[model samples]
Target: MVSFLFLDFDGVLHPQYDGEPTPKEVCFCHLPRFEAVMRRYPGVQIVISSTWRQQFGMLQLRAFFSTDIARRIVGITPTYPADGPPRMHIREWEILQWLKQHHASNKQWVALDDSQGDFRDYRHRVVFCQPWEGLSEHRAVQLSKALQGTRL
Candidate 1:
């Protein structure tokens, strides 16, 4: 009865403010806050659902977090074709694809992302993060509560 957490890096891990990019040194600044919440819920496993996965390998991606937290990140979602069918919720589609591949379609899961439109069809399954604030305490608390429920 393991729960899944689809993690996004750019907007959710660090501030990805509009008009300007975040400095590399300032990236992942909110990771500690996110890790703290994950620590409270050890049963929740994470999967990288960020675009960063397209550029970096799994090991490199995991290096962003503390060792303990890194291990909890089991895998990354499958990438979709850029020219595939027209769709508004590509992120949601990718999450479902990952769940299906793992044979965990029935498992409890949620996505942490800044783009609400990406999860329009499954709004209830997403813990929206503000790109300008990243994983603030408020967003972390929401994530904690989402994971607090008993696994189905």
Candidate 2:
């Protein structure tokens, strides 16, 4: 089965100190560790679940990552309403919508986010990260374990 990783930026990337950042302020603090771990799981593809994707669009958003990581991104989660006010409780809904569109129920998927949000039944697929630490070494290890089809 295909393996998918739903990646969040703010808290999960670095730290969500002052809320949403401008394009220039987006610092990839722990991206090196993230890349080190991801290198071991070449089959896993990333789907941006960050609000950045909703704000910046794919072309600009992909520019945030290094070339190696950028190549692994398959897509971003769909925006709410197709147009209009952004929907609340989007992480869970967007993921399900994307999965349905891709016919990807059988794929192994995981989300790396600081807030639990409304994961609901998909809680088992999450690898909770600390906002202050971003993707720490321990967290990356947990993700690697999950990607290897093992319990973290």
lDDT of each: 0.87, 0.79
- RMSD of candidates 1 onward, in order: 2.0, 2.9
Q: lDDT score, residue 81, model 1?
A: 87
Evaluate residue 124 in candidate 2 and report its C-alpha lDDT on the 0 to 100 scale. Answer: 79
Clashing residue pair totals per candidate (backbone < 3 A): 0, 0
Error of 2 at 89 (Å): 4.9
Model 2 lDDT at residue 143? 81
Question: Candidate 2 — which residues are off by over 4 angstroms?
Answer: 18-26, 82-89
Q: Give lDDT tens digits, candidate 1, residues 9-93.
A: 8888998867477798888899889998899888889999998999999899989899999999999999888778888888998
lDDT of 2 by residue, 112-150 (tens): 887776476777788888776678888988888888878
Candidate 2: residue 33 lDDT (0-100):
77
Q: TM-score of model 2 relative to the true fold? A: 0.85
Q: Candidate 1: where is the Cα deviation over 4 Å?
A: 150-152
